[model samples]
Target: MISVGVDVGNKFTKAVVLKDGQVISKSIVLSGFDQKQSANEAYDQAIKEAGISKNDVNYVLATGAGKKEVDFANDVVSEVGAGARGAVYFFPSGRTIIDVGAEDGRASKCDQNGKIVDFAVNEKCAAGAGSFSESMARALEVPLEEIGPLALQSNNVIYMNAQCTVFAESEVVSLIHAKTSKADISKAVHDAIAARIISMARRVGVEKDLVMIGGVGNNVGFLKALGDGLEIEVLVPDKPEYVCAIGAALIAAERN
Candidate 1:
């Protein structure tokens, strides 16, 4: 039996195909202006990779901020639950999960089975979120892929104290005008975001084996800062961003 999971995130659309509880294939594509098209593209690519047909997929579970746009989905799961479930599926021992996505940031506490017991989320602003970081990369005239590594090279970073993305833009611009190094500025951005996520984790009683999930989890620089703040080793999945879609597919299998 095959199950499909689609995650329509703000920045991208991801899809995964599962056989039993294992992910056979997955794809991620930029969301573009047309979210529906993006979701379809992701689904198509995943099916191609899995060597399966649309009819072969027993169920399609949707998740993420824009799951409703995926017309083909059988059901939609909460992003919070999806992230927590995904993290635990990828790292079964993970007690805490910090998920930073394009639209928002979230923290969740889960049991041994990866079932979420509590969570917190910030949807009002982009501060400390993926979109904010992407915007910073644009303002700094650097690629998103380079921001993390360059951030690690900074000697000292000037803190971005504000949580508002608009205000942070003005602050970053002022820093640039003052000739602040890009490395330091990038480090500061990661630190600023880590602070926000840490608060959410602490409130939920962050435990050992904390894992960082979501697309933001791939940022090695951000993970370093988060580790320092939490004073613990952060467990990251081999394919961090794909975890949600993978989890959704696994959950879909249960229904089938």
Candidate 2:
């Protein structure tokens, strides 16, 4: 069966095309003002890459913050469910899942079969999501892609006390005025975000074989901080941002 999945997230929209159980093509596009347009663009790109027409697809599923905006989807799944299913597809041993995107962070405890047992979410807070790192990177005059690697070079442990993104930006400015190294400040930013994620994960009862999937999973500094804070290795699948889309496609195949 050929199935397609479109995930319309806050920052980006992703689409994946799968043939039977294997991924054939995937696409990602910035989610601008119109989520529906973004979703359609991503889906079109994926279909083109896969050399298939919309008529060839057997099912189309949507998931993520803007899932409801996908008017063409045959069905919709919650982010938690899609995330858990995707994580398990990559690592059957993954029982605890953490997904951190542009605007929210979530943790879920799932069984071996990808059935969610418990879950927790940190939403509507920039401080608990990737936007916090983006804001801090901007304040430090560092490129978003370089900030993660820069944080890994710091040996000093600097703590950031501010919990709000607005206050945290000011704190970053203060650190700069105090002649704090950019690396140290970067580390502090990652540590702060990791702390919040760890706290949320704890609420759902963290377990071994933990997996992290989302756009933020690509941030090495944040990944290191999260692992260190949790005292456990966090597994990340290739192209982590597409996991939810892939999961949605898998579900489409299963449902049909």
Residue ranges of candidate 2 with Cα displaced over 4 Å: none
Off by over 4 Å in 1: none
Per-residue CA lDDT of model 1 for 155-190, tens digit only, reads 595778677888887888888998999999999988
The estimated TM-scores of all candidates read 0.95, 0.99
Top TM-score hit: 2
Query: All candidates' lDDT scores?
Result: 0.87, 0.95
Return the lDDT, model 1, position 146: 95
Lowest-lDDT window of 10 residues in candidate 1?
A: 154-163
- Top-lDDT structure, candidate number: 2
Model 2, range 1-256, lDDT digits (tens) per residue?
A: 8999899999999999999899999999999989999999999999999999999999999999999999999999989999999999999999999999999999999999888999999887998799999999999999999999999999789899898999999999999999999999999999999999999999999999999999999999999999999999999999899999998999899988
lDDT of 2 at 16: 96
